[model samples]
Target: MDTHSRSFAKALSWRATGTIDTMIISLVITGSIKLAAAIGATEVVTKSLLYYLHERAWLKIPYGRKTAS
Candidate 1:
């Protein structure tokens, strides 16, 4: 498993990207800045937790991972 900080940073970066994308999509579909921002805010928190857990889980599985020299 990777260090908590590494996983957290990765999650934060991924969540930032995902939140931007979500905001764009939500804005286009909903045509409401407030609604879009709300959706983005929700995704930022929920997806960050999900992404961190997902990364941790993947780190535990050794399949297809190469060992460092």
Candidate 2:
């Protein structure tokens, strides 16, 4: 099983990549750096929490995992 800290770290790293993508898309559509940054900032918090929860939940599932006899 993955540790809580490890899950948290993974969430953060994943969020960093997602945030950048969101900001780029926001900037392209809105043509405003400030707006893009605001969108990215909010996404960072909300999505990070969501991702962490999702990761933890997946750890409880028994699908596709190998076990030693």
Candidate 3:
């Protein structure tokens, strides 16, 4: 493992059990639940884009080398 990977893993860990992640999850869940109501519109497009962006943004974080600590 390298520094970049470590940092990325750290970022994911942070996102997994925090306020930011909770909000993201909630948003996605709600959007999916409401998809039927919004058929074909900006809402679906925006939700799709947001999900992609969120994944890509997290991918940018660097995972680092392992440490004794």
Candidate 4:
């Protein structure tokens, strides 16, 4: 495969593994908290990006949280 394709494949594999791990962790945490379903990769990535921007002061308004302070 080409370099870009290889890189993308590697990223995909890594993301898949991370998703699985996140799912398992989410399952445990949610079970403890009595939450419903385990969040997926999309949600985790989106939340992380939002938090990064928030920490950078780029996102002043809360994106996912119930209250924005």
Write model 4 residue lDDT over 6-66, tens digit each, in one string.
5445555665676667777877767642232346646556655554444445234456656
- Candidate closest to the true structure, highest lDDT: 2
C-alpha lDDT score of every prediction, in listed order: 0.94, 0.98, 0.51, 0.54
Candidate 1 vs candidate 4: the TM-score winner is: 1
TM-score of each: 0.90, 0.96, 0.32, 0.47
Cα lDDT of model 3 overall?
Answer: 0.51
lDDT, residue 49, candidate 4: 53
lDDT of 2 by residue, 2-21 (tens): 89999999999999999999
- Per residue, candidate 3 scores C-alpha lDDT tens digits across 2-25 of 355565565445533443444555
Write the residue-wise lDDT of candidate 1 on 1-69 in tens digits.
579999999999989998999999999999999999999999899999999999988888989988889
Residue 63 lDDT in candidate 2: 98
What lDDT, from 0 to 1, does candidate 4 have?
0.54
Best-first order by TM-score:
2, 1, 4, 3
The segments of candidate 2 whose C-alpha lies over 4 angstroms from its true place after superposition are none
Looking at candidate 2, the ten consecutive residues that score lowest on lDDT are: 60-69
The number of residue pairs in model 2 that clash at the backbone is 0
Better of 3 and 4 by lDDT: 4
